[model samples]
Target: MSQTVFCRKYQQELEALPFPPLPGEKGQEIQRTVSKQAWEEWQAQQTRLINEKHLNLLDPQTREYLMEQMERFFDNRETDQAEGYVPPSR
Candidate 1:
């Protein structure tokens, strides 16, 4: 089940306590919160891991195209290193 569902269920149980918590009860809630947080953390980490490991493999033409795009971007940019010519905004 989703973390929200788990939290809601456990929260209901905590609220149904006989009286004030016995000090450590709050720790249980904190642990559940950490676990839910870790689940999301690990999920994002897994996505990054998958992309880094497998999904981002670049073929030759793709790499060439990316390089061409970068070159084009920098080509249109001006710097003091250029022939002192200012770029006109189109």
Candidate 2:
């Protein structure tokens, strides 16, 4: 059976990740409080942020920005978006 957690984003008990997405306290907190679905959502948002903003992963500033966004994302708070980005039409 999959591990379960009281997902902070969803406000319910749900399946949890098998391991933390990062090291240290933040990752531990995510493992304890974030759901698999929420994590997936963050992944999608992270991708969008990276692509839209043209972020360079090797840059420490970009990584720091992403980490801050990740925190806000899991906390159910608004995160910064790539300026002037428009969603592609379906």
Candidate 3:
């Protein structure tokens, strides 16, 4: 069975990531607190932000900005959205 964690974003027990998404303490923290579902959603949003804003991952500033956005996303705080993008209706 997959591991489970008390997701910080959802405030409930949910499936945890199999491994850290990045290297270092921040990644470990996320592995311990974030749910897989939440992480996946963040990935989709991150891709949207990159495509819409033309972000360059090689740039330190862009990486920092994305990190900040990731934290806000997991914290359930206000986060930036891609302009002119619409969510598909369920």
Ranking by TM-score: 3, 2, 1
Measured by TM-score, the strongest candidate is 3
Instruction: Please list all clashing residue pairs in model 2, or write none if there are none.
Output: none
Which 10 successive residues of model 3 have the least lDDT summed?
1-10
Model 3: per-residue Cα lDDT over 15-66, one tens digit each: 9999999999989999999999999999999999999999999999999999
Q: Estimate each model's TM-score.
A: 0.25, 0.85, 0.96
Weakest lDDT window of 10 consecutive positions for candidate 1: 13-22
Residue pairs with backbone overlap in model 3: none
Candidate 2 lowest-lDDT run of ten: 79-88
Error of 2 at 15 (Å): 0.4
lDDT of 2: 0.91
**Residue-level lDDT tens digits of model 2 in 21-54:** 8899989888999999999989988998999888
Residue pairs in collision within model 1: none
Please state every model's RMSD to the true fold in angstroms: 20.3, 2.5, 0.7
- Ranking under lDDT, best-scoring first? 3, 2, 1
